[model samples]
Target: MSPARLIGLLAALLVAVAGLGYLASLTLLAPAEIDVSQQQAYVAAPVPAEAAAPVAPAGEPVGVPVVDAGWLATNAEASGVPEPALRAYATAQLRVDKSCSLGWTTLAGIGWVESQHGTIGDRVLQADGHSSSRILGPALDGSGSFAAIPATPESTMWHGNDRWDHAVGPMQFIPTTWDIWGSDGDGDGVSDPNDLDDAAYAAARYLCADGHDLTTGQGWADAIFSYNHAQTYVDAVHSAATAYAERTSR
Candidate 1:
């Protein structure tokens, strides 16, 4: 071949190789985004009334983390929850109710709605399952947008207020509720609501209380409404939980 023709052929080969490399890089760098509505339609179809599954009695505390790291990592990526928070939610299930009807996704929904898994307001959820900073809500002194809640004797210890009670920690539990349902989930023997592990376990126990069955739509709605009376809150939790379940199903 002529020198010019040979040079042109070499240039064409180089261009083709570069094009292939660009395509491969695109494939590796940008994965296909998850189709949430499609996944929910398929994987999270509404349960029939007759198909409601009963929750079993809560098991004794296992006193250990029960979720596999591999599973936690996979779900954390898929559901947009940090691995530490995901582990807390999953382990809370094993610690309290191992019911097939309720999964970690429900607790995760609450965590996300309440405090974004303790990362709300730019705070971080530490590796030890505690928030980098305290996550406290406004005082419930029966003032604007809040109901009146007189401070309990130990309220100041948790929320730094002796005049009025505030919702404390990642789960946003008021002092009275915390007194009844607080738990120690990390095996550290302290039931601190700021700790994700303990807070998650407390939430699970509260939701699963009195043999609540979460498989059916009505039952699940009731459980969430008990957490927060607002219908919008229940709907938001349902939406988040359904999305998480759909994402992790892949």
Candidate 2:
């Protein structure tokens, strides 16, 4: 009814609106929650000695380790790895040098880091063990963040680039490395780096090379470091592997 009364009411309404705005800002600006259950330093898991029969003769098709489908499905769901990619990693553990003690989780860890099990960037790992689309890394022309690697005659075929070599496939194998580690994992007779099955098998063999026993801390770290040639990469893979292992262990 009075000017002073009207002014007092307006001031109270403005203060109330400012308080609501501050509360809304706090709600909108709050950081998202992060899961940190497996954030500790990497630890090696116990690996059992070879208890299965000897691998098939060199000339014969290598026998894939018989894995339970349900087990693969369960672990895949837990670790966010596709069923086919998870199968490739699990089978690789036994198909590789049995003495190396490589765990499936380690392979899954590398797959997660390299390309999220070949499903990164709108790419899906098909049931036939191939990525829906070809995944290639930046050119290694010794530019800002990449090593200067000239394309070799053979390297051009895998990546289709004549000037500079790029890492190809889900595992991101460079031309040089793929030449040494490429393998046929799906019994298709062709060793293709773009195929998740073949890439995973190749990665396993590379990690198991040089008599590295992946069950030991030093051995595991060295194997991962050799794959990426970076301590940071090794650490990330280790952390991913550790998380996968912990998730599937339960």
Candidate 3:
């Protein structure tokens, strides 16, 4: 073969090899670009798609916390939380079907705060969860100490005055607040806030409003804050509730 022809043939072979290498490089980069795009898509929508599962059915709870008669009897006397009222709290927890379950100890905590489980000021809880006497707060006459709500009297005899409204029952819910969430706990057709059963259920319903998730510590704090605006009140309720839960879980 001639020398020039040999050089030309070598050059032609080198070009073909370079062209093949470039084509391979493009092929390799194509999937990488696609993979990067797929990653970006994943970053945009990272959550899993889930079905709308039912939580509680017909005002009944899906996960009912176990508070047996034995447990109830022991805690009731010690904590002044009545058995019927405790049962009512647990039932409301399940019945309300909030995403976050309202612990019974939390109810006990509220009981401790408001009226000491209906044992405050010579008042006592009856067998059916009714207080021996009305548990009313000082008139919210918008004075130096209390909130001056412009609400009229729901019932003068029950609430004690005509000027302003006061809270009722062990939970310290004002009549207007109770009217929104009042329930018939004993199924006798009357929704009385003076009754612990009705009061407890109403309290739970009030707390569970706005789909507030009460599972995390923050969620619990937020719920309590909503119930009472004071930071001190929220802290006290959380502490009391935590203590009760720690005690009873053992």
Candidate 4:
């Protein structure tokens, strides 16, 4: 072969090898441009404490503390019973009413158990004057009294006056019972069951009159029994009162 022809063949072969090497490099190498934003998005964000924690329902029992005599006394002192009528009643009762504090405490407990500390729906009379409804209006007796209407027929477990056909107010006292025994428990110049203080005081009066003593186990039990003859009723009131006392003390 001629020398020029041999050199031309070698150049062609070298060019072909170079082109193959370039093609292999292109096939083996990866692109440098990456989408870091998508990767970051894939990594979930941190959740807030509120979002992470389980939430409790409204008016549901959380943690109820134990209520003792000392706690009751402290609560009585702290409770704002400033009305002259209320103060007078408290003073008079304190002189001879040994279980006044206990009565108040138990009443508070009963209120909590009965109405979840008055957070339940408002009580109002029905248009018929004999019946009562929780949501509907036109209060009977023309007293503009805010009574607790039965949320359901089952709510009658507390106090349902078959005669009046309605559940009563703050303390869940039946209208019939209110008629017979309801008085200004707090001496706040009001005998309405919607008034928390009055209802608490009234409950105390009823329990005390029924021979319950907060200072003694028997008395407490008896008083609770008087409120409702059921053992479950007594247990619930006692438990709730004890819990409330403990929580308030804290």
Candidate 5:
């Protein structure tokens, strides 16, 4: 109740007032209540103009290149092409000769199926003391004119130096046949069975020469058959050719 008590009481009162004012200011500055019935609308942010717009899918009747048979015959050297150049060459060749694209693809597939893309080998021994060998099939026919008579322990044909041989290379061409039919496919001036370009072009030429149209569906089938006489070979070639077309088109 004295002067000191009065001062203390006044200080307490001032503190209480200051606390109340701080709380009041906070409540007054607080966000207003959101409406219940009058709901707030939200809009998605606009996409940036620089953002790429969704691209529409290309419609059917998509442009596909068409290739000619005669052109393939003349450009048989194209098969010797390499890497990125090889792909572009193949694409261009197939585009112009897209009709024969199936034929080429079929040939490639057949080569794969027939000889594991030409990775087979064979050894033949002649009874007359002459020895000859092959890879893939028994050296075609006129390759060496030597008949493979199987091995002795096998009871198939030859006993010592006369026996049939396996095929080799990407196209599965016998060493002898390759010596004859193999050609430069990539324009590198060297015919190699291991070369995909050379192999592909050789196959194209072989099919074209084998009474295949290289331009029509039936021709494609015929060319495939000429490569190998197996039904599986035909089916595999067709499937591969179709797949190649689809991939290249994309």
Candidate 6:
């Protein structure tokens, strides 16, 4: 399907199930700017990535001063971030020209919370930022916990489950969330969920929606909260991000 139709479907679904208020932060880029694939919400993990790891996408600045690959490798355990993934965050931060400059550490923090930088329990991140094992969340079962989003297999050809939809990629975004916020971070035609570079960049865009500057306390808190609605999730991400910033971004 065309990118416009995909976006319209995503926005319309969210408005129908979640409410119009929840649509406030969904980014609305032109069809040309947005990724043009209905399958973009969850790029299948089975497809092998391009052998050469992705660099910064074309036409973006690569002038970020955040921690480099050497630093991440040296302090791997301390930051719990791998070199290539760290580099992706740094490059995305440098390239994204927004009022609320996203730092590499913030991505690291969220990465830590989401999937341990795609190293969850021995699943390692490959050069292309695709995790060895695709991490996913259980059905949003609504049980008064996560906002119940009906299984989207009917709408999404990406995730094939019939009874429930799983959150794809290292970042654990539901199909709806991925549909509305996903983007092609790697310059590849597809906005893959399993690719760390792709996932990290999409996440940066999502958090900074509405020009949210994450450098300040409230802004930091708000952005994290937007990523996940829970206060505990925000606190955990903030703590990790702060630790990373104190040592890296500063």
Location of the lowest summed lDDT over 10 successive residues in candidate 5: 36-45
Model 4 residue 217 CA deviation (Å) reads: 1.8
Better model by TM-score, 3 or 4? 3
- Give candidate 2's error at residue 34 in angstroms: 11
lDDT of each: 0.68, 0.68, 0.57, 0.40, 0.38, 0.59
- Candidate 6 segments whose C-alpha is farther than 4 A from its true place: 1-78, 154-157
Compare candidates 5 and 6 on TM-score and give the better one.
6
Q: Per-candidate RMSD vs. true structure? A: 16.9, 20.4, 27.5, 35.9, 35.6, 15.1
Q: TM-scores of the models, in the given order?
A: 0.74, 0.74, 0.68, 0.45, 0.43, 0.67
Can you tell me which runs of candidate 1 are displaced by over 4 Å? 1-62
Give the range of the ten consecutive residues with the poorest summed lDDT in model 6: 31-40
Clashes of 3: 3
What value does the lDDT take at residue 19 in candidate 5? 24
Clashing pairs in 3: 59-95, 61-94, 142-148
What tens digits encode model 2's per-residue C-alpha lDDT throughout 1-250?
Answer: 7665554444333322322332222212222222222211221112224222333335566544545556667668976779999888876765776567677777877887788888878788999788888988877877665677788889998888999888889888887777666687766667788988888888887776667756567777888887766676776776677666655655
Model 4 scores a C-alpha lDDT of: 0.40
lDDT of 4 at 237: 60
Over the stretch 1-250, how does candidate 6's per-residue lDDT look in tens digits? 9665554444333212221112222222221211111111222221122222334566665433333334446545444568767756755564455466566667877787777788876898888788887777655555445445567654255456666677767777776666666666666556677788778877777766656655456776787776776776766666666555444322
Q: What digit string (tens of lDDT, one per residue) describes model 5 on residues 117-234?
A: 3332332222211114422243322244333322333212211223443344445544444444555554445555555555555555555454445555566566566555555556
Query: Which regions of candidate 2 deviate over 4 angstroms?
Result: 1-61
Q: In model 4, what is the error at residue 200, expressed in angstroms? A: 1.6
21: Cα error in model 3, Å = 63
